[model samples]
Target chain A: MNETGRPQELPMSNPRADRVRDVAKLAGRPARLKRGRFLAEGPQAVREALVLHRERTAAGESGVVHEVFASESCLDRLPELAELADGVALRLANDDVLAAMADTVNPQGIVAVCSFVDVSLESVLDAGPRLIAVMCQVRDPGNAGTVLRAADAAGADAVVLTASSVDIYNPKAVRSTAGSLFHLPVVLGADIGELVAGCKERGIGILAADGYGTLNLDKLQDENAARRLGASAASSAYALEAPTAWLFGNEAQGLSDSELALADHRVAVPVYGSAESLNLGTAATVCLYASARSQQAS
Target chain B: MNETGRPQELPMSNPRADRVRDVAKLAGRPARLKRGRFLAEGPQAVREALVLHRERTAAGESGVVHEVFASESCLDRLPELAELADGVALRLANDDVLAAMADTVNPQGIVAVCSFVDVSLESVLDAGPRLIAVMCQVRDPGNAGTVLRAADAAGADAVVLTASSVDIYNPKAVRSTAGSLFHLPVVLGADIGELVAGCKERGIGILAADGYGTLNLDKLQDENAARRLGASAASSAYALEAPTAWLFGNEAQGLSDSELALADHRVAVPVYGSAESLNLGTAATVCLYASARSQQAS
Candidate 1:
């Protein structure tokens, strides 16, 4: 950047340039892992990355966004993105270069190379999180992102994905997050056993979202509401208002038997109709929102 | 004449035959509309079709499933599917035939051609539905299917799709329903204006899921719970326990102005954190489950 904080170089026009290829390579898992960077495509994701980058840099910390590439029209369309990317490496690229640098066909004309945003599990646990969402062996990138976005909406303190779960850095997963990927701290390669143990030590209750679990989620919510309303003493299985960590399992097979056993209680989101079960993302959203409401109300 | 109730014809092994092509055409909307039939692929969907077919056939009504096709290995693996197709035209086919006749590259070895199952909105209202889910211009087949599946899971009495919406009969949408499509009554090509008027006349309330609405869903749920627990009067703009139809709008733009205006109330799912708004499916699921819980508790 020059003294005026404007891009110093000419607009990148070559789609097959080595720099474009390098940026596009972040779409692959191996490249992402090797460089500790991932692609944040589209205006929403790119804007969020830039915002986080600016905030971190302002706070005297390393920024999340490494570099941003955008078409001239995208910059003209979303001027705030340029403002947000103040000190970051924001370079102009033609549509072809932007497209070639992005995993998404459109990328809506902007893509950012973001540093691996996941933090250590210990760091997340140290924050004394009141609510956490964990994905166990969730293979689908879209499902993983949906759950992450839901977790963010639920005001989850953090989100964790086990080693067996899909890599959240996948471009599809990043797009699926709809910018929520930049909103919360994430911990990858987490071991469920350690997380369970950590939460137990922190007085954080663990609930497994199981289809066949004995505890009905509605019953639990009703009990929580009853308690809040000062109803007569009822035998409560678990308190929804308490600090909690929810374990969401795979898209197909839910939490394995061992994973279910790790939780303080197995809670079933009551299936009132003939659906064999709720999809993973839907179930996680319901569970997180239920807990978020209960905790927030208290 | 053979008195036994069984498919008298030999297994259909030809993939390129006119009959095979006709069956495959159901994957397209025009063919499906012309024939009034759609394909249900995979064991789960086909099994549900067969079960519904058997039930309808036994009840002195026309069956849903017109013809059943399966590979030998599929029937061998899922013997119950064969039994379910006892009275239906069950034709054994090679995997090649199954693949060619299915939209999915792999149809899981079984497919069923079923008649259009949508009923009129009047009939749905006539049945005294306590909870109905309506999708307004929800173009994505997968999102529509997700909401339908969620509605079914919430035990909603019916689901409705406005004329501007995607055809729920799209194979992808049907698959997304995960067999929930056959569980409850569905009304297609509904006019939102007419639906609102009819629902009002029938005393079924309408709630549009709007992110910018003044009504908070959690507060409404809490109020409903409080009333059930005998709390003093809190002026609730609406009663969630009342017979209701929830209108979920387009995924990207949400409910249009006119669509939102047709509702008795516009309700917002609270975003506890940084997420701008919940996805259509997640919001719909939360709203439906909230109403289901309140109604069931009452």
Candidate 2:
């Protein structure tokens, strides 16, 4: 190991090495599932992964990051990553080798092979989560990641993707999360029906984010704020301060009839202008933030 | 014109034609600027363009749509497009011709050439805009469009892009807007210094969306909601309900010092979790919606 704790021996210079090809294969679903690992690329994601890895290891749990590959110049520029990866399998590689193992043309000169981070739904529900975000059949990787990142920003306890939803471990989805992927617990390939029943058994409210919903999210937020501030005693149909799971649906069709039927209440983020509706990510962010503020404020 | 009011006489079949090349060039800045026109590809954008065109022509103003090209299948599926383009020059074209002229791999079988729709800063100020979103050197086309769409959903009076920002008329930007581009006014090539001065002169509050800002957005919202609900009479440093202009910075580096100095206050969206920060679109949405709710509630 070098003085910086980054390995300086046998730098990976061959882009077509068998090891490099093996790492690159993780970009596909079959490879990722078979190996029980995924790639976390770029500085932000890799840094967060390393932090998580350190925390888990320090706590006597299995680490999340399996191995990390970084360019020498990357380590030189962001030395904290090298320090954070002290006991991990750290390898110095050329940019071409790094790129060959990455999904993006430029992985910002760093990438990490991370163990699957998703926990079982029971594990998340057992923690008594106050706020959760669920995506049902959300097809696009970008949309899926956006919702996950927004959920993290909103302080959501966990995120759940129903069966048939885009894979959170997809390279593009991981990039879109912008490191928030490592910030919170996630449940993937979950059955919406079973998840909803599990939440109900645990006394969690379910809200569906729908454009044509009967309830307005703003009114609920306003009511919650008023109630919290001692302004009014009026009761809202749904309380934003309660432990809740929000269901967000497909980008184009939104929540299907079956999906919408599972929710306790259908809520719409008010659109005060001519826009037909907010995009899935925008709507989901608004809903999550509203719930977060109400629960936190109270 | 046929019975459906579409120009079915001469179907555009040759993708190699000079006219097709000219239309295709609208995807680039030089061609767009030279012709003072841009492409609105796909069903949603073209339909919105036609709606705006009809409204303008009915009011004795010049139409926005110059020409529209569509495949027969697209018009057949969406007959409203035919009715909306009654007074416009609409030509039926084959999918190959349409694809050749479009920037996207799939134009969804329709495209429109529309005049530049940006208005002057003075015009926006004259309209007494209560809410404005200004992008300063934000280079991503998708980010620009997301902000625009969010602003529309929030009922902002206008959106402004300062010098060096991405061109909102870029094809990708237009597609990202999802037809919200036609729902509100936009100003382009704005100088931040002069624009701030103009907004201040019009009694509009200037708020910069900064991560390091001293003000917390949630506190401001809570205070505003409390005051509006007669729960608290406490005053905040900045009134979110007042006529306000929000400045969003570049995706990577954020606002320049000069740009940030122009704002009356730098307000940061409250991060409730471990996320380093929200993405440009998410932050912008939260800010705009907060302002919209505050202003509208009062």
Candidate 3:
């Protein structure tokens, strides 16, 4: 213990001690996820966020990291720690205290409280995003992260999550993204009406993925196919064009009538098995990949 | 109390009482999952399994359904209950007991303990499965189920899981499958080498999805370009002409060196996101869909 009431150092080499500390923090939901921030543990998540921070610093900009905390023991173990914290604020906290801030029981001995990088529809759209994934009332953090990852892999423009969806910054969600969350601009809390209007203004087609809807995903991906699925509309040269925005809904209840009606088209993945529907994460991946393939083929 | 020494039946019509019983059971993991049998609570899962059972029975074959338990009080509430329970052995277990057998905390007032269905590798391959999914050491039940669901949707022949993987019949895995488990043949507890050899003997190409490995999935799918990936030779026949199997490993240590070497071909999904890697379930889905698309295009 140090004079500052914080442990002067932490030893991360011991897996047992590390797990014990991490479990304690993650056991309590409140301590694990506070109002303004959440924990980002796990080597994959921490490493990705750290790389994003490094990229910003290398470009002569202040790193995006809000704060960096690592077990004293972890500092010695991680050879690149010094490089990651070159111009960023750093902290030495007790392993347990740091674990308490994490969302997983198995902490990676290092975590970063990176503030959410706010992104806008205009900025993301301006980057020539050909494919965008919009999530509606999908509250599962893991599902949200998976969607972000799928969008990134398919080389989509951006991923925008609606207000009712899970928080993109949630530790579990961020980790699930496998670091793709950092590569893509993730926008949270967008009004659906305003979003649809913004896309309309930008001449971007809105495609809603609804389970109960009639449109077939494979059919929609094929432009040569004449019949469109649900909510088909006339193309406005730029609008109703290829490389459009895709909307996905809540896992249980699915997209609301209002949300479905707002789209220019609705599509459903054809099912041969007895499954009533696909998992939200699986469905999103399939849809995003379908659109990406369509655009690529064209 | 019943003379049979079973606890007194609680009225199911009372929402508060039903909720109390349901929560109590979910807290006790053992009560939710036991040897040889597990709970499948959701309507979709319960319905699908029942339908599969019926299809078999209608074909002049017998099926095993231990018991059908439902809320006696709500028998009149949901008119379809009777039709849904089409001639299954029924017992009016108390609402509290039924809750104990439910997988979810909020019981849907429906559950069943069907005999665990086991399939032989001969039967799976005999069906001329063009696509197969193999999990080397996937440890998460949810991930296992999600993979199975994806395999089913993409029209994979079957999913073979090793003993090192989580139990496919685990309640959480079953729920995650959303009824795909019953729709497809899932073989657990198998020798990896034997399974690989068996598939090879059947002229099926085995592809291991390794994140750290060499082959890019996109390039492999590109038929017009160099379709070569992994150590094995690419089949000149279209992807549909060659039966294929995909192997996924544990979340932490991924596929072992030997397992990767055993692959007829190996491919990695192109990643653009910051996520260290995709979650096991998401990765499996992506690979399965890619193969499906390639085969369709070919």
Candidate 4:
């Protein structure tokens, strides 16, 4: 305890520390699912949470951060955490102990246990929805993170992670977000049928990206031309519209038949080479950015 | 050695296997560099070398691959490798020993020792002379690999790495390429000034991607509007039009002024919201794809 009389040390006996530790271990499948909590480690992820918190504050939204843990050495080395947790509880732990809690081989020397940002299908759709990314069964932690990062960068209003996708809480997935997980509404464990239904209820269009599809993205981004094309495509025997949700599927087995049936639009990114397919992450980034560009132009 | 008058196997005294094992141990900096050659392992990476070998064969070019090595298991698993080794010596070793030489946490049960593919600046520029990616001082293997993969998908002629960039042969880097390195020309250890001069010599364009640059990529990709609004800006006064190479710098320090000044064009991918900036890999993907799009329109 310093002059202020508040304990600056890690409360080894504290229930909260125990909880954070428990959550950190839950980075594996069982724990992530059991508690409806996922572990996010590293400085970039935690820093993004702080920024998200600030954005929530500015927007008058409830964005309460649960807990922040740091090595005293980290506290001395980096000021961002102290600044982010100005009024919150910041506990110092052994540097080695803190290092143990980090998922990365090279720890940034800080970690945080955060509550998932809550956003519902209704909220995402009702927010005057336009661009969104629906990630289905993307298994790679790095790939999931990359998609989320791309979604955030492309200004997708929300990212819906289907049940088959890698858990968003995995430390790698969190790190991959490049902190975009905090910038937008990331809805995880969403059901496919319900997601499609929600989008339909909210008048959001659904576009499925297939490398073999007949539609060209460049033509889709043109408002006047797209309006004409989308009119015939949607109104005729086949078509789609703007205010779309782009659906990306599994890395190996792509979008299932049932999932594909839900899309009103089928689009493909052209490839000039012999490679079987672009890695899922790259495909999604290309499509999402294409959609973003189209939306921006219109 | 099996009986039946067979030649003595001598416990499979595989020299290539021994070399792979030695290279794996060299990942520790002192070892890697102490010997001028570094280990490039895994089936995909080896396959990449084989593809390069094929390209060189077709082009009547030579000196692409120095050697190919595999565990008896990999050869059994991929029988096609046997056919690919026209005159190259094939040596088999124990699986466990090969595993020891493997860099990935899970060895693909295959490893190869090959001289790095040496491409003169003239060769790469002459190959397509339209698009290229220049990387400076990028340290992360995965980031480097992902960039290579992206550059490949974007159809860039080659990926040039400065001396400070992570070793292209790093196992993670090799894996990240996801077999793209096989299809693409990757020139490493070239001085940035020389790379710039080579691109200029070939009548190629140059664009340096910087976080602080004011150029909007969307405008750059919009050929019709850009042609009218910024014709000179996109051509003589700014853009390099003959062919083009987009330069990317290290993740942390970004491009130095000297490197940045060497480019004919500088552009930034616009960012909004509270996120700091895109990851190096993501930024490269976005920039490379943008260049591809710009070239397509042109």
| Candidate with maximal lDDT | 2
**Model 3: per-residue Cα lDDT at residue B293:** 57
Query: lDDT of each prediction vs. the true structure?
Result: 0.91, 0.94, 0.69, 0.70
Order candidates by TM-score, high to low: 2, 1, 4, 3
What are the per-residue Cα lDDT tens digits for candidate 1 across A1-298? 6544457678999999999999989989999889999999999998888877877788998889988888777877887788788877889899999889888888888999999888899999999999999999999999999999999999999999998899999999998899999999999999999999999998999999998888888988889998888874797999999999999998888899999999989999999989888999889999999999999988
Indicate which candidate wins on DockQ: 2
- Model 4, residue pairs in steric clash: A233-A238, A233-A239, A234-A239, B204-B243, B205-B243
Q: What's the distance in Å from true for residue B3, model 2?
A: 2.5
Better of 1 and 3 by TM-score: 1
Q: What DockQ do the predictions score, one after another?
A: 0.85, 0.86, 0.34, 0.27
Better of 1 and 4 by DockQ: 1
Task: Please report, as a residue range, the 10-residue window in candidate 1 chain B with the lowest summed lDDT.
Answer: B1-10
| Tens-digit lDDT string for candidate 4 (A1-298) | 4533233655433324665468457567687567555545667777777667777767997664566666666666667567876655566666555655667755666677666674787777778767889988778888888888888877888999888688777888888887787888878888888988888888778888877666766455433223432332332322223577989888777787777888886777665343446677788877877767666665
Question: How many angstroms is residue A6 displaced in model 1 relative to the true structure, after the best TM-score fit?
Answer: 5.2
lDDT of 3 by residue, B161-269 (tens): 8767887767788888888888888888878898888888889898889887577765555441233222235554335336788999887788999999899766776
Better of 1 and 2 by DockQ: 2
Return the interface RMSD of model 2.
Answer: 0.7
The estimated TM-scores of all candidates read 0.96, 0.98, 0.82, 0.83
The candidate 4 chain B region of ten consecutive residues with least summed lDDT is B1-10
Q: Give the DockQ-based CAPRI class for model 2.
A: high
